[model samples]
Target: MTSPQAAPLANAGPALHAPLLASAQIVFAQVSINFGAALAKGLFVSLAPEQVAALRSGIAALLLLALVRPWRRRAAFSRRDIGWCALYGLALGGMNLMMYAAFERIAIGIACAIEICGPLAVVLLTTRRPRDFAWLALAIGGLVLLMPWPGRAHASDPVGIALALGAAACWALYIMLGRRAARVGAPNAVAIGMVAACLVTVPAGLARGLPALDAPVLALAATVAVLSSALPYVLEMRAMGQLPSRVVGLISSAGPATAALIGFVVLGEALGPWQWLAIAVLVTASAGCSLGTAPPVSKLREEPLT
Candidate 1:
C-alpha cells in the first residue's frame, strides 16, 4: 500500500509532464505549417496562388469534416454560433489567400514576418497595458528594417508587402472571431469554419480555371492540406486545451524564424543579416507581448466538443 505522500507524487507525474507534451505538440504544429507553406510555394510553378489556396482549404475542410463528423452536434449550435464560425472561416480564408499571393512575390520568411504583426496588433488592442507600447515599437522597428528604402540592396516587392499586411489583418480578425466561436466547441467551430473557408477560396480558385490533376499533384495537394491545415489545427487545438494561452503564444512566436529556416532549406531562399535581425526583433516583440498580456490559465474556459 502507498503512503499518502507517495500517492500525491505519483499523481503529479502526469500533471507535470502535460505542459511539456503540449509544448512539443505546438512546436511540431509550427514545423508542419511552415514546411507545408514551402511545399505550396513549389506548386505555384504549375498552379496559381489562389488555386493552391483553394486546394489547401478545400481538402482540409473535407478531412476535418470526415474526422469530426460535426453533424451529430448540429442541433446544439444556434444560428448566432454559426455566424461567428462563418466569420472566423472567412478571415481564415482571406488570410491564406493573401499569404499565398504574397509568397508569389516575396520570400516566405519575410512574408510571415510581416503577417505576424496582425496578432501582435490584436494583443495590443485588447489589453490596455502601458508596456505594450514597447512591443509595438519593436514591431515597428522590425518593419522599418524590412522596408524598401531607395538605397537598400534588396527590397521585397511593394505589392507583396501590401498583400502580406492584408493577410495580417485577416489573422487579427481570425483570433477575435475564433474566441467568439470557441463557445460552440472547438471541433465543431473549426469544422464548420473550414467549410465556410471553402466557400471563400474554392470559387476564387475556380475563376482561374482547373489545372491538370494528376495523381502526384493530387497527392501533393493532399499533403499540403494535411500538414498546413488539418494536422496543425488538430495539434494546436489539443495543445491549446492543455497549455496556457501565454505558453502557446510564446511557442508560436518562433513562426517567422521557422519559416525562414524552412525557406532556406526547401526553397534556397536566403536573407541578409539585417533581415535576420528584423525577424529576431519581431519574434522578441511577439513573445514579450504574449507573456505580458495572456490571461491566466485559471481564467481560460475549455468547452468540450460533445
Candidate 2:
C-alpha cells in the first residue's frame, strides 16, 4: 500500500533470485489478494461486512501471533516509538474497515477504482513532471467512462463513496506509518496491526454476528481470513521484497481488474463493454505513469518504517 517497503529490499532485487520464480510470486500474490476479496464477499450474506473485516483481522492476528510470537521477543523500540506504531495500527484498521464497507455498497471494481485515487494522488504530488499529468487525465477519463451520471432516481450511495475515499486516504497514511514502524524494527507490523484491528473490530463483530458464528460459519470465516488476510499479506510482502517499490505499486494497479474478474465469477457482478474499455484505459494510465517514468536513484533509500 505505501509502495511496499522499498529501501531495505530494493537492493534485494530479482537479480539475486530467479527471474521466473520472482515474477510468478508477484502474480500469485496479486491473484491471492483478488481471491481474498471474493471470499470476503462470500461471507457477506451470513456476516455483516464489519464482522467479516473483524474476523479476518482477528484470525490473521492469532495465526501471526503463533508464528511470530512478538510477545516473546525483546523490546525492539524505545518509548518514543509507541506513537508511530499506534498511528500505523489505527490507519491499518481504518483502511480495512472502509474498504470492506465500500465492497458492501458497490461492485469491487468500481470501489477499488475510486479508492485508487489516493495512491494516484501520492504519485502525482511527489513528482513535478508534466507528462505525469497525462496519467491523471487518463485516470479521470476512465472514471468518467465507468461512472454514469447519478440522478436522484439512480444515485449510488454517497456514503459508500466517501468511505472508499476515506479508505484511500487511510491507505496513504498506512504507508507512511508503516514505514516508520518498519524503521523501529517492528517487522511484524502487519501482524500486530491485525491484532490491533481485531481489538477494535472483534467486539463490534460479536455484537452483530455472534449468533451467526456456528461451526460452519466459523470455519468459513476462518477460511476467509486465510484467503483474504493471511495469504495476500504474506504473498504481497514476499513479492514486495523482490520487486522495486514503483514497479510493485504499478503492478498492483491490476487490483481493480482482478477484483472485476473475481466480482464476475463470485458475485455474478457484470459490466457493460464500455466499462471493460474503461478498465483498460485506467490500467494503461497507471502503467504509463509507472513504467515510463525512470526509477529514481533515491528509491534505494526508501524503506518501510514499521
Candidate 3:
C-alpha cells in the first residue's frame, strides 16, 4: 500500500542517482587516463612522441573495432554522423599527439594544467549562470597561477607551453564533437572515431621506421592503449551522453590535480608550493561546480550503442 507521496519519491530515486553515477564515471576515467599518460611518457625514452601516439591510437582502434564491430550497426549512422565521428577522432588524434610532445618538455602535471584550458574555454562559452561564472573565474585564476613567469627558475619550456595550448584547443573540440557523435551512439561513434584517429596518428609514427617492436615496448604500448584510450574513451562517451557539456567540462577541472598526484606517484615528478596551490584552486572550482542539485533526468539524452 504505497502512499501517493511515497510513489513520487520512489519514481525520483533513479533520477537522483544518475548524475552521481555519471560524475563517478568521469572521475574514474580521468584517473585512468592520467595514469596511462604517466606510463606512456616512459615510452618516450625509446620512441618518439609521434610514434607513441601512433602506437596508442592504432592499438586502441583495433581493440575498439573488434569489440564494437561498428559495421554491424552501420545502418544506424548517417553520413553526417560519420563526419562528426571523424572530426571527433581528428581532435582526439591531435590532442594525444600534442600532449605527448608537451610531455617531452614539461612535467605531465604542468602540461595537463595548460591543456585543460581548452575545456575551460568551452565551459566559459556555453554556461550563462552567474554561479557558473564564479567557478570559471576560479578555474581561470588557477590557470594564471600555473603560467611560467619570465624570470622564474625551472620555468617551463616555451615550446612546451605552445604545444600544450594546441592540445587544449583539440581537447575543446573533442568535447563538443564527442557529444555530437554520441547522439548516434557511444560505442559506434567511438569505434569509428578511433579509426579516424589512427589515420591522423599512425602514418607519422610508422615514418620513424617501426620503433623497436620488442615485447616490452609492445606490451606497454598495448597497456597504454587499454587504459588511456579504450577504457577512458568509452567511459567518457557514455558519461557525456548522460550529462550536459558544461557540467562535463567543469567536472574535468579535476584533471590537473589528478594528473599531478599520479605524476608524483608514478613518475617521481614534484611540484613547487605555488604549483600545488594552483592545482588546489582548480580542484576547489570543480568541487563548487559539482555541489548543487543534479540536473533532471529528462534533461539527459541516452542513446544506446546499438
Candidate 4:
C-alpha cells in the first residue's frame, strides 16, 4: 500500500515477542498488494488500463473518505494545505495511471521492479554517504540486466517499460509531497488527496464500467480496491506501529521478489534467470538503502495520524 502521509519510519527497535505474528502482518501486506496487482492485470483485458486505475482510485477515495471523515478537520486545513493535497493527488494519479499502463503490457514482476526505481532514487538523493553508492550502483546494474534484450526479446513491451519509468518518477514526487501533507494534515489527508486524484482520473472514463454492469468485473474491481488500498494500508500501519523500522524495511524490501513470485504463480508469467537475478539485486539495493546512514530528512513525528 502507498504511504498515506509520508515515508516509512526512521527508527524502530527489534521485536520483543510474537515475532511470527508480527512478521506475518507485514508479509501479508506485501502479498495482498501483489495479488491485487495480478487481479488488476486481468481486468485490463475488459477495461482500459486507465479505466481500471481510475476505478481503483475513485472507489478508494470514497471508501477512505467515509472511513476518515476529513470534514471533521475542515477548519484545520488551510489554502496551502489544499494546494499540497492537489499536488500529492496529481502525483498519485500519474503514478497509478502509468503503473496500470505498464501493467497492461508487462509482467507484474517486471513492472514492479521498474517502478521501485522511484524509491531507490529518492533514497539515493536523500543520502550523502559515499559507501551506499555501491548499493545504488548495484541497483542500477540490476535494472540494466532486467531490460529486454538478447534472449529476452519478449520480456517486456517497450512502451510499458517507458511507462513504468515514468511511474517511477511520479512515485518519487509522491514521497516528497506525502511528507509535506503529513506535516500540515493527518492521515485524513489521504482521503482529501484521493478526491483530487479522482478529479484527475475520473475524467479519463472512470465511470465506463457503470453502464456495462457485469457482476464479476464489478466484484473484481471492488475486491481490488479493498485489497490493494484499504487492507494493505491497515496492515502496514499496524505493523509499523508494532515492529521496528529496520525490520519493516528489510521485510518490505522483499516486495519486488514477492511480486515476481506472485506473477509466476497467479499469472503464469515466468522470467529468465537473469531477470530473477535482477530482481534479487534490486531488492538487495533497497534493503541496503533502508539501512543507510542518511538520517531521515522527514521531520514528521512518529504518531498515528488519526
Give all candidates' CA lDDT scores: 0.84, 0.68, 0.78, 0.75
Which candidate's lDDT is highest?
Answer: 1
Q: Once superposed on the true structure, which residue ranges of model 1 sit more than 4 Å away at CA? A: 296-306
Query: Which wins on TM-score, candidate 1 or candidate 3?
Result: 1
Q: Model 4 over residues 118-159: C-alpha lDDT tens digits? A: 777777677677766887798889878877785675466788
C-alpha RMSD between model 4 and the true structure:
7.8
Select the stronger candidate by TM-score from 2 and 4. 4
Instruction: State model 3's lDDT.
Output: 0.78
For candidate 3, write residues 1-306 as lDDT tens digits: 999879988979898788889888888888888888999999988999999999988899899999899999888889999999999888888888888889988888888877766655665566567886787788789877767887666566778878988998887788788888887787787788888988878887887788878999999999999888778777877788677755765566677788889999999888888788877886677556554324431122121111
The better-scoring model by lDDT among 2 and 4 is 4
209-229 in candidate 2: lDDT tens per residue? Answer: 564678887887787777766
Best by TM-score: 1
lDDT of 2 at 110: 66
Q: Model 3 misses residue 127 by how many Å? A: 3.3
Please write out the lDDT profile of model 1 over residues 10-106, one tens digit for every residue: 9899998998899899899889999999999999988999999999899998998999888899888899999999998998889888999999998
State each model's C-alpha RMSD to the native. Answer: 3.1, 7.5, 4.6, 7.8
Q: Pull out the clashing pairs in model 4.
A: none
Give the per-residue Cα lDDT of candidate 3 at 38: 93
Instruction: Give the Cα-based TM-score of candidate 3 against the true structure.
Output: 0.81
